[model samples]
Target chain A: MSTTVTQDMSFLYLISSASVLVQLVMLILVLISFFSWWFIFRKLFVIRNEKRKTDDFEDIFWRGVDLNALHQRITSARYDSGSLERIFAAGFGEFNKHPAGSDLDAVMESTRRAMRATYQREMDYLESHLSFLATVGSVSPYIGLLGTVWGIMNSFRSLSSVTQATIAHVAPGIAEALIATAMGLFAAIPAVVAYNRYASSTDQLATRFESFMEELSNVLQRRAAG
Target chain B: MSVSALRNSSYSEPRILLAGALAVLVHLVFIAVLIFGLNWKDQQPEGMMVEIWTELPTPIQESVKTQSPPKQIKPAPEPVKPKPEPERPKPEPVKPEPAKPAPQQAAVTPPVKKPDITIQQKPDPIKEIKPDLERQKKQEQERLKELEKQKELEKKKELEKQKELEKQKELARQKELEKQKELQKQKELAAQQQREQAAKAQREAEAQRAAQQAAARNQITNEISKYKALIQAKIRSRIVMPPDLPGNPIAEFSITLLPGGDILEVRLSRSSGHAVFDNAVERAIHLSKPLPLPPDPALFNEFRNLNITVHYRE
Candidate 1:
């Protein structure tokens, strides 16, 4: 009998045999964990791609590539271009829309505005679904805890129906309940770690974009002044 | 609106699908690995948490074992010597009797006393012959000759009697010596048989005692395990382990028990470092009063002080 009980203590058995509420809670945690991981991976790809694109654009731009040629190349491949390139194209297009003798400060301001708007959209694209990761990181543990508490309560309540209460009587219930907490920890740890890593990387990319925009604005203002 | 349009165009649907597929694959792999790992773990042999005291160091057992050999050797020659000693005294009396009888015969027959007896006989014959002096003188000569002849015959008869007595005594001495020799041989054989019998009896008794001791030790060990299991099971049942105890921490306790199975003392020899677990174990030990002890009083020593470990899992 004990052998059977010990054998049935596997995670699959425990999860499968859990009470309805606990099962529901575990389901919620699993869904949260799955989606959180999905977002984590997607964000990982997005941030890495964005960082590489920014590095490419910065290298080419700094090596004194002709603004017109660079702008033309970026605009031709607009759909395939990175966020930094789009921001540069937006700023350069806004600069060329003014006459050669236009007010330098007004042209520079409008150029900065276009770059800022594009920068905002690119940052939004990079950080999408990150809130879901943050929510999973913060909330899944509590949901798992709730499942555990409900499981323990159910087990103890069932104890009232029995005359003798051995650890055997209550141990399986408690063991099954503990799996919820374990699942919560399992889901929360990775989500929290991924969220932190992706958030910092996105922030780094935003800084790079802002610096590039500032440098471009200065260069365009100098050309207008010249 | 333009920024939203541009962001929508920048998004690649294939990449999202790829990431999602990878995520599902990763989760499925994790579940499969978990299932496989747990199944593998199920095959693992559970560790033994309870250690029972089967062999006790007993000085008396060693003494009993060492004392059997000398006892077998000591009595072999002891009874043989005393029995032969009493028999030797019996032969000594028989030897002295033959020697004493020869000296008594020599002292009884005196040659001076024999001369007096001859003088008396001569006087008696002279009184009767007073009237006939001449005839008496001839008769006296004849009587003297007869007396001399009778004395010589009597001396010869006494010598023959002495020779016969000496021969009889020598024969008796020879017979007695032979009897004593036969008796001694019989006694020596009896002693040897007795010694062999005694040795066999001693060996059997020693073997029986050894067998009994071994049986007793086995019984003690069996009873110890029986009661140890009982006490541990009872305590384990009574234990209300604190939830969330990390790992399988073992709490060791040395329990002192009375003869009647009542707990005298319980000291935590090794703490599991979880106070709640330690306290729960301690409480359980206290709650399980009057543990099941072996009925035999001799086996009580084995159950007197027990060292028990309560593993968190077990």
Candidate 2:
């Protein structure tokens, strides 16, 4: 029992002896897991920053800070603005472009257009590569299954020439096959969990940006009317 | 300008490269942990584990010997002492030598003769008791002589009985010897008879075996001929002998057969001078289809090719 179990159950041993196709599958799974982790971390930081900056912008905006002063301060700073800040910046920047005597409807129309464009662009940045995470989570196991199927097929293919087969004869191949699946799950579980978590956070941030846009347009309309 | 910068920062190639490099570092750490941190040796339970399980200390088994009942010890016999103490008075007899020394003074020391007289009186009593002792000793001697004579007579009678018992044993021994000699003669005769019977049985068995072998050989030869005739008969039955074509014709065809007896080829080794007779023989062999073969597969090789001479007249 011990001899058969330890035949190729070692991590390095399994990796080294795995068939080419299963090895490739394992490589792909590891790459997916790693690359997805990268996105997960990057999005984690980006979405957190957006949420923080949006909250900060909302607090100051409600504190009755002068709009022109606020806009100037954000534009002067070299840092990239959050989704909400960028939408506000775009509207304020577009509003400042019009002359004092310009048609109010025409001025508000162009400002809304700028904010809308920035909103979409900012949300696009937040949601970028999220589909890759979803794909990794949803499809990685099947890809791993393909590797397992191929490995088992190879083991059985080698077995056809043999007159008798024991567990020791087939264990290594099966173990290597299961390694693919284990790696796939390792890649997929975090990806799925992160995707669910980050997708929800991004959606929440998008909702906040949309609400801020509506409030900003209303305030700008009052300013233009006066 | 700030908004444009912000939009470009989100999809920056440098950020992706940095993230990918960091991910590579993470994967390396994971691989290292899997390689170095995993204790591979402890995972397997080896043959040594079974040996360790039986390593408990063994208890020594002491053999208990059954004790024998102690013998009743007796006092040992006392050693005998030599009895020569009565000769101690011989030294006192030396006083008579000192009496001889006083011979010159014998007449003058006549008053000292009283001690000599007492000493002389001491031997008188010893002399007087000696007669009684001698008589008692003579009587004891006679009694010993009588007991010795009786023991001698009993010993003579025992010797006579022993002689008689020896004579009877000698007679029985001779009778046993004769009985053994008779039994041995009978055994020898029985062994002789058995030897003769064994020789006769061996000879009969040899003859029967030889006859059986010859019969089996003849049966095999007869069976072979019967089949050969059968094959020849089948082909002959199919033959339309060319009637009245010429002198009595004969055709010999060497036919090749498969294991299933399918005729492979029929070559005329010794063709009849008449072409019609030879053609008729060839046609008959073809019509026979699969020729009859012996049931024995061993005979198949013999039928691989067979030469059968057909007498057209017959």
Which pairs clash inside model 2?
A: none
Clashing pairs in 1: none
- Per-candidate TM-scores read 0.50, 0.50
Residue A10 error, candidate 2, Å: 1.4
Model 2 scores a TM of: 0.50
Task: List where candidate 1 sits over 4 angstroms from the true fold.
Answer: A1-7, B1-5, B40-314
Instruction: Residues B1-314, candidate 1: write the lDDT tens digits.
Output: 33344456688733787788878887788778867876676554223111112222234544664575466447656776786688778767876786677656655564665668657755755665675576776777787788667866876787677778777987887898788778877877787777667766776787689789999888778878888899999999999979987898999999999988889999999999898888999999989998888777888888888998999996
**Residue A127 in model 1: lDDT:** 86
Q: Could you tell me the lDDT of residue B122 within candidate 2? A: 45
Model 1: per-residue Cα lDDT at residue B125: 59
True contacts kept of each: 0.33, 0.38
- Please give, for residues A42-111, the per-residue lDDT of candidate 2 as tens digits: 7776777778888888998999999999888877763655667778889999988999889998998999
Docking tier of model 1: it is: incorrect
- lDDT minimum window of 10 residues, candidate 1 chain A: A1-10
Restricting to chain A, the TM-score for each candidate equals: 0.95, 0.94
Alpha carbon deviation, residue A53, candidate 2 (Å): 1.3
